[model samples]
Target: MELVEKIKKSSVTAFISRIPKLHLAAVAGLGAILLSTQLLSNNKTPERQRTTISLPVTVSSPSIAPTIAESAPQTNSAAQWRTEKLKIRNGDTLSSLFKRAGLNDRKMMNFLAATDDKASFNKLLPGKTLEFSLNKEGDIEQLSYVLSKLERYTFSKDNERYSLEKELREPDIRIAARTGIINSSLYLAGTDAGMDDKLIMELAEIYGWDIDFALDIRKGDSFRILYEEHFLDGEKLRNGPILSAEFINQGQVFSAVRYVHTDGRSQYYTPEGKSMQKAFLRAPVDFRRISSNFNPRRLHPVTKTVKPHRGIDYAAKTGTPVWSSGDGKVIKSGYSKYNGNYVVIQHGGGVQTKYLHLHKRKVKTGQRVRQKQVIGTVGATGRVTGPHLHYEFLLNGAHRNPRTIVQKLPKAESISTKIIDDFHRQTQPLVVQLEAETATLLALNSKGSQNKAL
Candidate 1:
């Protein structure tokens, strides 16, 4: 109380001495301005005063149990998209093909077995193709197929198993050829005929040196061939082997009998006992400069340094197939970082041969092979200058030219007296059958010609 009185007395004396010049408005205005400034400062948001806080935050993380509320089931792609084709082979049944293709729909099984026999029997044979579709998960979404004989069938699969549906579709036929000229390439001619390159090359291999397709085809040559042209309903699928063919080159005539022997071995033989297969094959390499000619000088293609090449190099196209020069056994087939892909054959009597720089090795070890059989394809494997076949022939551990060894094959021994008699007895009936069939075809053809003439 005494301090307040003293501050009041002092204020009154200071006011009297200054002659009291303060206006009431000025004092009230000053007090009001001070109050307003304090109110504004208090209302304004404070500057974000970040201090270096070193307090450890006891972060309480929420309970994060992985959620599993009705997740979608995983669908398998193997079940979704179909395998596209089922090869109908001898003794193949609907059930078996489906099973082999990994289809497990029981309803489809029962349906295929039940109804279709009366409408169209479900018999499978070689050279036939069937098609099917699958859902996104690779399950049998639908079943459909076309037979080579122009028959068709379809099926459907839902969550329900399978149901049969009959269908009729027109087949598309495409005529193609695989030809080999004695001097010109059959592969080239086949290309002109709109055949697949692979098929045409295969045909040359099937005929091989026997016909000399590259060297034998002449100008104005004529040939007529019959073969299975595959179709998938309205679309053509694949080309099959030549069933029959007639060739006329430079006034010489040739025909092949595609005889599937009862023993399941099929071979192309001349009308006589002579085999179309030669003892040694004609050299597949055509006139490439024989570099280093069976030499002991070793050179590497990459390093371009001295390295022994066991085989002779003959430059050719990549993917050109290499054939065994004679009947032999596959002793080795594999890839080497140095050798590339290679094949070694152990012919009888210690006559071994090796082929290197292959794009692919078709045969494996211990596989018995016939003359001119394809062992591998040519390529620039390992260290090579472009694509070529490196072929080596060794007789009793000595290198020999394949050309030297393969002029003609040595003839087989003559049949024994008893064996000849037995062979004659057995072959006589077959010869008669063959003769009759040949005569019938000729007669029919002659009659048709005469009719055309008339």
Candidate 2:
């Protein structure tokens, strides 16, 4: 009894000395632990015994860590640069664009140059988008141009401030395409699927010579592309070189690849080196919608007679622009009772194109016109319906289906001497990862088949 009283008195002093500031629950837990340890030392107190298990220390958990997670005061923004995009509307110039982007300076003049300054600003096309990334200081860190696809220019900074540097933003093209089905034009489907309009344009240009994009496209047609894709900062920015493409129209699948020979002249090819782009495009204009079909015996909606419709009619708003079929010389630009204000283009290799019922003729006789150049406008000037353009394509002076023109992509040159070294250096890591993942997938696939067999 005297020993127990002396032990209790010593424990009171120890608790007062070290454990007064401890939490109630912690103090109770610690007292129990110590009391159990003491009792464990005594075989006479077996029921009160306890075993202590120590925790392994971790990197984040110190021996004397505080019991709570504390967060620091946050003041700075997380983003160093924020990307922004704006589409060019009519009457928008680079100066206005710069102003809108909060860069009210003469810096754009340094970039546009005097040689093409006025032309660049005045020749604004609608739906063209320009992208820019703004740094924390509100200065433009980078500019992305989407003329066809994205081109980026980065700003360099030394001890002083930032300065823009022109950098070639290549397509980072991968020969690739995806099959899509649409009731209308491939243009509609491509843009709908977030496919870059520039890529769609390139695809059309490549196959312009063979496929008549207007009359040949049908519902349930699927297309595939093996084309170049672009990337910036490991994120896909736009399109690059189109290595190959396949478009299905009216149950026909058309395919082409970029082919470069030993001499360095490149062209779009079939599995064979057949040109996808011919001397002429299958049709002169990408008509908005087909208003009339070629029929041997059908009543004219306007003429009210059972007449042979030799050509196709495309519907568009009045003054909706028309384009030339191919690079050609204007053979005739005149008005006739049957043809109205019409223009005829005589192409190379005995091919010919005709456009009738124009609102106004853009080219005069003997003037040269390139493919996609403005030829005229849609008008009800001829012996036809409301606002529509009558278009015709003749090969050796005979009618062929306009949609059969094969599109040939421009050949992509080998990684050139200038960019090849840099491209390899930049893309090596991604290539390695992609290759490794592909190998892993192959191995797993093989293993799965073996398991299935068993």
Q: Whose lDDT is greatest here? A: 2
Q: How accurate is candidate 2 locally (lDDT)?
A: 0.67
The weakest ten consecutive residues by lDDT in model 1 span: 48-57
Badly placed stretches (over 4 Å) of model 1 are: 1-184, 190-203, 211-255, 260-266, 283-327, 333-338, 359-377, 410-454
Tens-place lDDT digits, model 1, residues 1-454: 9999999999999876775345444556667776866777776676633334233344687896655653655466544465568777788776777777766658455555544333443456577776768665555666666664555566666445556676655556553333333335455566664567665554555445444443445666654444557686566667765544446667876654344544666554433433445555545543223444445577665787886665567676777767787888998998898679999888776788888889898899899998667888878888776888888878799877565455444643333444444444544444455445445655776798899999
TM-score of each: 0.44, 0.53
lDDT of 2 by residue, 1-454 (tens): 9999999999998887775454555657877888877766776753554467553343675467554444554444435577778888888878888877777657565444423213424555688777767777675555654554444334443333445545555544443334456767788887764568787777787777666667766777766555566665577775676566667777876767665545675567554444565555566665667777776586889768898776778888889889986788999999998788999999876777889999899989999998789989888886766888888767787875454432432332344555444444544433344335445645766798899999
lDDT of each: 0.62, 0.67
- Model 1 scores a C-alpha lDDT of 0.62
**Model 2 lowest lDDT segment of ten:** 405-414
Q: Which candidate gets the maximum TM-score versus the true structure?
A: 2
Superposition-based RMSD of candidate 2 using all C-alpha atoms, in angstroms? 13.5
